[model samples]
Target: MESMMSFASDLKSVSPLTSGCALIGGVVVLLFIKKVAISAYKTFLRPAIDFTKLGKWAVVTGATDGIGKAYAFELAKRGVNVVIISRTESKLEAVKKEIDDKKYGVEVKYVVCDYGKFDTKARDMIAKELEGLEIGVLINNVGASYRYPRYFHELPKEEIQHLLTMNVDSTVWMTEMVLKGMVERKKGAIVNLSSAAARYTQPLLAEYGACKSFIEKFSCSLNAEYSGKGITCQCQAPFFVATKLAKMRKSWSVPTPEEYCAQGIKWIGYPDDIVSPFWIHATAGWVLLTIPQALTTAHFTQVLGGLRKRGIAKDANGGVSPQKTKKN
Candidate 1:
């Protein structure tokens, strides 16, 4: 009886509102813990796809830095040779050299191709270069966004054209170029990097988000059509990671490219066509998607509008952002 009384006294029963608030808080904490635990297990413990078993060669676009570069090295470590493509020859060569020196013990080759402007001859060259390779994996990681988000109508004509071609057309054509080889071989994995922004409306980034959404839908259908033939198409939709293209620095919210790519590589052959491979990214996505669409869009647009203002000021300082003189 004394023990019972002591326990009851310690409880110090509170008002119903206080108890209700405490209960809710506890539930939220538990849910967050569960999500974190599950995501950590998936990121660190899951067995990565045996990429070498699929083929000898892996090709990555936009491989000079960030996620693309990280994936190229990850594949090389798995004893697969890599072919990297990017617009800057110097940057590509530097990545290739880094792969070589890191002693991945796999061949590292690079192709220089710019996605901002479509070039028939360059496309043919890429195809020709890949013609004889026993390609196993294709990482369609090249992508672009607005220099800063703005209303769709406010975007410059050149910027619109660039984003459409770079973000959408490049993925389509590159996949077409590589997919036939995979189908014929009857064994391959293709990882197409999309954006989490696609899952919800991004008012200031309408076209960019739309293109990513298209990539997700396209990857799912493509996988269904070809999975029976031993091809796996994965469309990964990451929320954000610090990269030059994103114009952001690495943070807890924005994982470094290496960390993101490591988790991403582990998710190859993952059952879902769409994925947020990083732990924090997946958790943030779940939370954001639960909010009302109107609320989310309103908040996002305001944030992006600020970025647009800053971008405009910077470009003005830099003398109109150096428009390319080349037609290509």
Candidate 2:
């Protein structure tokens, strides 16, 4: 009976200890779960793109029209002075005037230079114009694809060369020019305009897509390298934007340039792998990564190519009809 009593006492004494251990375990598990939940919320539920923190001057190439123009307007709205670059002096003047009249408390400057051909004189001219100004943001937005719908081989060599110069070479040179200053200052942001076609292999825009892919990869890698130095770089790969360029295409999803640019600029300060409205599409590549690559590529090509052919694409002048291309 004494032994029995002793055993009961021992069990009773250990019961509290066991209970305490269980409680501690439960609390530890709960804390771990809470941490995981927070991480997940920040990773998935939060907005992927954000640029509300930027408050410096921004330079946008091809800023007179389409997404570029929208970027300029959005940046100005965010209290950033703008340096607009493009070939058309009249268009640049008009855009500058509008921005000035809007009284956004931001300065707007214009640089009229063609990117189709690399001219040392033109580069020097642009450098001189930007010599004294401090540019906090550099947007490599100027690009070109084949205007008329044609097979890769069907396009003229000159046209292809021009496209390469504008889309790839010019972007590289401009980035080099600005990045030097950015690296020296240890502060800057660069946003390059890539395309959804960069990921998918298409029949018509083979070179154009390839060039964009280069931009996307280059910007991402560069971002990784410079992020430690207070510099951020992003390559945006949006689907068809309503622009004069999109009008020449037969079909595209065709978001307004304003909508695209708004989202893009918003993403400049946001943390994410890439910034693209196309991600919201149910059938987009990012959503369907588990599917076969060949099938995804085919679908993208057909849908986007069809849109280009239909002339339903958007442009800088807004959503005008196909016949009204020259009017803008």
Highest TM-score against the true fold, candidate: 1
Tens-place lDDT digits, model 1, residues 1-328:
9999988886777777898999999999999899779778777798897888889899999999889999998999989999999999999988998999989789998998998875688789899989899999999999998878788888889989898888888888899998998889898888898999899888888999999999999999998988899998999999888888886788888988998988899988655678898878887888887899899988988898887887776677674433332233
Per-candidate Cα lDDT values, in order, are 0.87, 0.76
Which candidate achieves the best lDDT against the true structure?
1
Off by over 4 Å in 2: 1-55, 248-253, 271-273, 277-283, 300-328
Worst 10 residues of 2 by lDDT: 46-55
- Estimate TM-scores for all models: 0.84, 0.74
Superposed Cα deviation of residue 277, candidate 2 (Å): 4.1
Residue 139 lDDT in candidate 1: 95
Candidate 1's C-alpha runs over 4 A off are: 1-41, 319-328
* Cα deviation of 287, candidate 2, in Å: 2.9
Model 1 local distance difference test score: 0.87
